[model samples]
Target: MTNTDVTQLDNPLWYALKGAQQAYAIGSSHIRRYRSGILPFAAYDYRSPGNIAELDSFLEKDEVFFLVGALPSLPSHWKLIRELPCAQMTLELPPAPLQTTTAVTALTAADRDTMFELIHRVQPGYYEPDTHQLGNYFGIWQDDKLVAIAGERMRLEGMVEISAVCTDPAYTGRGYAQQLIVHICRTNLEKGNMLFLHVLTSNERAIRLYEHLGFRQRRVISFWKLINAGTILGTKL
Candidate 1:
């Protein structure tokens, strides 16, 4: 078997988080234009003037919207949005002695419906605004029920993101999540792509798991979703 190289992976976990957005038509014409023109792969370019206006307009157009990327620190007038912790896990296979379970496999077209349902069940309110463009989502099933899953979402030329990871809450204590992560990183490394993901900084449990599984801590980024006239006058997070 070809050995995986974890050292060559991308350093910052936020890189994958940059592309979580998908096009939506509910925003103002200008907002839609700006969001469409925004580069999904470049996370830094969002600091430009009117970027906040664009996002705020986008949010006001709809009751709720999804914004993924580093959020800038703003004033107290804005609500404290949910925080997603970002992490980068390397592809280093642990000793085989530790894994003594049934084999895991890639997901198939037949698994899409059930897989998505299972994901929502585990991580409620998590939905891809653009499912048509969803990348390589994978899963492991047991006796026809999807148990654990981890796979790609936003992808650029040299990078692929690992996201939508969810295991049945009832099966939490098991190593199912670790197994799925191992499979994900191995596949990405083999394909010459690096793996990255975002999680809430407050989620100590997940942070511990990633660190134990060979993932390193990366820089923190503020994630935001502004609506109406929610522009930052002058600041950076």
Candidate 2:
């Protein structure tokens, strides 16, 4: 496959807010985060105390947010929660034909609570309450319950990150998550957008699944999770 300016992938969140996902952006030109309750992601043109302070301006006391790539050293007002290093994989070629054995329906407004609960249950912290509004999400209903789901997040001009791919524990090993993933990858590729996903490097099972579906490991981005400490040293945090 030909490499076509995947440099933007190096700092996907920042470029995303600067490009296609600008409407969801907040903060100054150099440093920014997504609108509250959309996605708790922030990016900057460069890392510096000034940028950190600028980002601080966009958040409230006790707020939380994420920064991918290198985890910056916090200045008392911000506390390091966890450094989640992830394997960044990309799909240049189309995935295997979507297995249609199970019906994957487009999740609607009615399914928001169910979707939120399931995603947070399986993969908490990355997703926000209103994250479903960011992109088209699909699900598989079994036994009158939403068992599996996969959807988009952190969008750039011509790229989309596949996220929230999860399934109920009782529904594992039946390929429910796999089906939703294939459907999402295929659907996004058909729209001419480059596809990529971030799975924790420790999640060998999920990584293998994506690889089997034709996603190759492009790099590893260390996503730093941080929380606002309100104020410290008598300075507004």
Candidate 3:
């Protein structure tokens, strides 16, 4: 469907949210932002329609918005702001590896702390306390230490998002991310769902790695974050 038709009840975001509890689970942080009085500058989904005047009222206070499903037409009163093209990638299964590694295994409860530390070491900004508590996490262990991890985030109908992918810094060149991605996607495929993920346009290396591992670019998306009024410059997200 075109972006203009997003106001319809069948908008992708609505169906996606309704169909995928995992998506809702992963995105709960975002939804909570609006619920907690952080005005979303980029609200989409059209499941609950509101006019620009309605948005403008909130816009002046804080403009932390999200654009989901398809882009919507702005009201005449609103002016253009910054726009950047992001990308979504999808990989079909059984995620055949370009290289091989041991079978992916479900992370045990004991593995959680080490898994968190490994991910945080590579990507400290990841794993808000909320995301950490969200779902079952999976990992690849070398000896007793967790080397890499990938797991469920969002779910919609027959699809699941593979997220929280990270590798230990010292282990970067070993293709752990690739192995974990294949293992995760294959695991999801066995359960009869497709895999999809989002990455920044500037992350060329990651995009290339995903492509090499059989993922293809599905579409370009715009990630518009509205600046929260009280947020200090250079503050972490």
Candidate 4:
């Protein structure tokens, strides 16, 4: 599908709340969010009083969640904790070839514990224990240890997000990440799905690697992290 054909690309989180990943969503008519363990993202129809009120009702004291897409007018009970600027990137199928030296293996339930450990040690805070439910994951093992991984995350009818790409700190610079990304890209393209992903704007190293692999920066998205105004000084999420 062409860019114009996929309206969901314009407001990805909102559409995801209403699309394939909707099973994980919780909210009323105007607002919706993925369950806490699934993702920290939430989205509303747009900037409106009713939508803001509905969103506030779903948040707990001291709990934080991200509002992705265009900035919205928030309710008084919600506090703007932080604004993270991110780059929304998309790639056409079959990214340029990369040397596939390492053996990439499909991961399964048996690998969950080790996967979580590697993710927590390297790319923490975002990946959930059950994130594997989103789609297939592939890993590069070094001496029987999972040293790197890349996988699919969000999915709409015609597109799938390539996310949770990380490598153990000790395993970096080995070309594991690059190979796995290329594998996932080629697999998704063969399945006829467009690929997209998000990365922090400040991560220039990752940006360079993705661009070199044929992914292009689409837009700058704002991740507005909001906390309940009633939160106490030391409470945690």
User: Among these predicted structures, which one has the highest lDDT?
Assistant: 2
Candidate 2 displacement at residue 53 in angstroms: 1.4
Give the per-residue Cα lDDT of candidate 3 at 15.
46
Candidate 1 structure quality by residue, lDDT tens digits, 1-237: 234333323322222333233242233322331133122221223435244343342333223333444454433434644555444443333413346575777776666677767877887555433332456666667767878887776554455667777898767777878777777777777677656666777778987877776666645544444332343333322
| Winner of 1 and 2 under lDDT | 2
TM-score of each: 0.66, 0.92, 0.65, 0.89
Q: Write the per-residue lDDT of candidate 3 for residues 1-237, one digit (tens) a residue.
A: 112222222233344444434333223322212222211323443534443234443344344455454545555434445555667787742455465656566876566567667766776533443443334567767776777887765555666667788877766788778877877777666776667777778889999988877788877766554334432232322
- Model 1 pairs in collision: 71-222, 84-199, 84-200, 85-199, 85-200, 86-198, 86-199
Residue runs of model 3 more than 4 Å from their true location after superposition: 1-16, 22-43, 47-84, 92-94, 97-103, 108-113, 124-126, 130-135, 230-237
Ranking by TM-score: 2, 4, 1, 3
The alpha-carbon deviation from the true structure for residue 152 of candidate 4, after best TM-score superposition, in angstroms, is 1.4
Root-mean-square deviation of every model: 7.0, 2.3, 7.4, 3.4
Candidate 2 structure quality by residue, lDDT tens digits, 1-237: 223468899888888888878888997777888999898888887545355667777877888888888655556778889889899999855777754689989997788899999999988987888898888899999999999999998788778888999899999999988888888877877777788999999999889888988999999889998888887434664
Ranking by lDDT: 2, 4, 3, 1
Task: Give residue 151's error in model 3 in angstroms.
Answer: 1.2
Candidate 1 segments whose C-alpha is farther than 4 A from its true place: 1-44, 55-60, 70-98, 129-133, 225-237
Alpha carbon deviation, residue 96, candidate 1 (Å): 7.5
| Global local distance difference test of model 3 | 0.56
